[model samples]
Target: MNKRKISSLLAVTCITALIVSGCGGGSGKAEDKVVSEKDYEPYSKYESPVEFTIGRNTSHTNNLPKGDSIENNMATRYVESKVNVKAKVAWETDDMDQKLSLSMTTGELPDVMLVSRTIFNQLVDNDLIEDMTEVYEKTASEGVKNIYSSYGDLLLDQVKVDGKIMGLPMTNIGNQHQLLWIRKDWLDKVGGKLPQSVDDVWNLARTFVEKDASGTGKTIGFGMNQDAMNFSPIFAAYNAFPGQWIKKDGKVVYGSVQPEMKEALADLAEHYKEGLIDKQFAVRSDEEKEALVINGQAGMLFNPWWIGYTNYKDSIKQDPKAEWVAVSAPVDENGKFKTIRQDPVGGGIVVVRKGYPHPEAIMKSINLTTDFLYSLTDDAVQYKKEHASEGLTDHSRWNNEPTQIPMQVDYDDVLKRYYDDIMKADKAGSADGIQEDRVVSYEAYQEFKQKGTAVDANTYGEYLSRIEGQREANNPNLEVIPAGFYGTTETMKLKWANLQKMEQEMMLKIIMGQASIDAFDQFVSTWKKTGGDEITQEVEEMSSR
Candidate 1:
């Protein structure tokens, strides 16, 4: 045989020998046989039910119906019926990190759990989690595999340890960059076009404040909370991506300490001094700041497209005439709307405990759930309608699922499909071929079209977010600067917290004018001396690998 074919044959022989001899080194027990592609089925049900325990991370709001619970919800029941797999909640808490830490100490981990990147590393080092490479390859559905492959190697590479896949990385939605949400009605009243540059944004804000566009005599130019100003759209206009690791001059560098951040901070300090930003933003809670926008005291804020689904939805309800618009504005001098792109793999993963008899169960559950939610099957559509009848909204339903690994092939593509196939093709009123998860959004949009101002808050929010908000976020010209690295390093574990605290304090001080603009240089120097330089080197090494 040729060298390539011989090499592949040898590798297969070695793996078979290891499996038969039980000589491989892994936390989990050795497999009895190799599963061929022909024999393996993604959604095959077990002869008997396979039960696994999970340490669930629950939402603060218990949106489950009166008699339902995290363990007994519609998601759990559906999975059980379809795949013959049942999830028993070992323990659930809103604070999963704290509970997981305790579990590590007590040596009492669940059969499967979704954990953060830091926790995933700990589980690997302790050899408490199974090596899912083989199981995943053999049992993962084509749909799930396709989703991971869509990101190339980026998603799976995060969970690979010593060349073995230790966990399933959750693929995050792309284009999660913040957009400037403005009161378009207020802008019309002030007689200004949509902002195209940072200067334009500043001038518009000034006019909004001066004219009191809200007519409440208490209008603030920009609504901000304690941490919002640091990474706001204004900062992005200056190419300052705080909290992201971005490429600078062929090296991976922390965006927070870059020179561009200094310029952004100086500009923000000027705005704060000019009373353009909320004067009390330094002490305002998120809710308090949001209330400023909802109550018509503020005209502009920087948030993701989903802001319409949040407090801005209330803005429409409170004022039926209010018209909020999403924009990729405040571009740089070159007219490029530069924003930081999210990491491909969300820093969370689903891991199975070592010595679990049915490690493939988790893979099966992910497959079944993904198919049920997105495959547009008749059963899935019917299930969604029944759940909606019970007042179960999309916002909180997924929190009740046992295996909470979010698998999206490409959210931007999904949004594009919604825009093209549904909105452009005028199929918003049609349910044919619509996925179970997005049917409600289509329904809500239809209701908003029919009822206009009389539509409920939920319907208004849905239309605004899916239709209007996504239209802005899906801008093809918006330049997204991808983070160079997203993994945690050893030195980072020891010192990142203190370094982050130092950066946060210094950035806030500079923006609020508590410290001079020159303080940024000193902060950068101290950050490097303390741990930033070492962490950067580690990041460089990791990214290179």
Candidate 2:
């Protein structure tokens, strides 16, 4: 953190505010002596703008069209434009885990670093990051002030650690909810409405199997990438959100230990026994489940809205008639299934030196990033493909594209709205990699009430992998789980595992009828006797802070 730079930044903001507000005194000609308004100066005046060296995790340099890659990629550039300062991003690395760790070890942290809560904690514990509380309170401009107030508790909790605010945490934009995507055409074939209740879903899966709605006689009733990370939506179906680790009721609990978790597992085990789950699922990477779905070998999947655009639609090019639709994930009749939201913590914390330059710059970056992603227009065409992967033998990309924002959920909304506003934009005129003449099949679906069924009318770009028929298409679904809910402290981390494993293990056991639901009581007792007390205490303390 540069002290002189801080002085300059504060001075600049003060003077600007004064000059703009002070002009009220006279005719305001160049030579007119203007009385800057302010019942009086509340604090300091603006100093000359200074230069900063920012470090980012990116794939582009800061000299492309939008602002070169750096200028365009960060919202901080908006800050620069306002403060009349310039920044030279000293380093831009794509692998945040590797780069930040390396940078921390070398004691060369960026003036501003973008990272997640876990990493932020590690950095703070190591005494490598600065606290930004004063800066936030004093320097936040009007726009910066508003966002902080809007995000409120969420923003406050993310940056605070051990009762201290250390950095500017990233915020979630767009649809931060999960939705289930199912093949309605198959549902209709099975003489069923889309499954709504958990039991209803199971019954429908059985029907699909009995009837082979896909006509291939090989459709798996359900398919999901087996990664524990991607299991939130499915877990939600059973009323569970398995964060990497958690603390409940004051004890460290693990996901696998929960009795409900066991029930969930047993449910999975049952599906496995019935061959309703993808047989290859255990070994299937995220890529595999995706490929299975778009190829029609799997009729169901759990993923974000963008999946339809980037995965299924991309793969369906191989078979033009391939169609898909999305709906909110199914719940139990109690409507109490698990719907895991982001862990209320995310992206490593970004911190500036205590009393360093542009206190509001970090906040400005967040604002800019959000607006850039959600407030996109035709002029923003440059924003897309900033770091697009060129279809080739060797994959390469840069952080120069707008679509590169992994969470640009608004794209899903805009995509549908645009295509719907004028159907011609997507009519057969340009399906890109989409299957031509699929609408003819879709029309029949309409007669049966499948209008918004084909993901998003037609696809724009498509790609397929041979390993599995996983396709990438233009139909982007915006539904995604919340971000930043994974940053529990060390003690909570321990209790969370014990708790989760208890639930996970028991879920499988009960569904197998191997353990009766009555065992849930015993499991809860075990949890309480374990470290549940400590876990809950820590979580409650964290929330209070």
Cα RMSD of all models vs. native, in order, equals 6.5, 11.4
Instruction: Estimate, for each residue in 1-545, the C-alpha lDDT of model 2 and write its tens digit.
Output: 11112234434443453345321111112233222332112122324443445666665332334333443334334334443444556576777767876655444455566676656665565544556675566544444445455544655666666656787654443333445566666766667776566666677777877788777878677774444435465565664545434444554444444545645655666776787766666566767777776677666765554553366665455454555555554655455434434433334455663223344444434333444443332222233334332221122221223222222112222233333423442354443323222333223323323322333423222111100112111223222333323456557556767666775565445444467666656776787678766665565555444
Off by over 4 Å in 2: 1-49, 58-81, 94-107, 122-130, 137-152, 161-164, 173-177, 227-234, 244-255, 336-338, 361-486, 491-545
**Residue range 399-452, candidate 1, lDDT tens digits:** 424333333333324566665554733444476655556667777777877887
- TM-score for each model: 0.86, 0.62
| Residue 58 C-alpha lDDT in model 2 | 65
Off by over 4 Å in 1: 1-39, 58-69, 229-231, 382-412, 425-429, 450-454
Compared with the true structure, model 2 gives a TM-score of 0.62
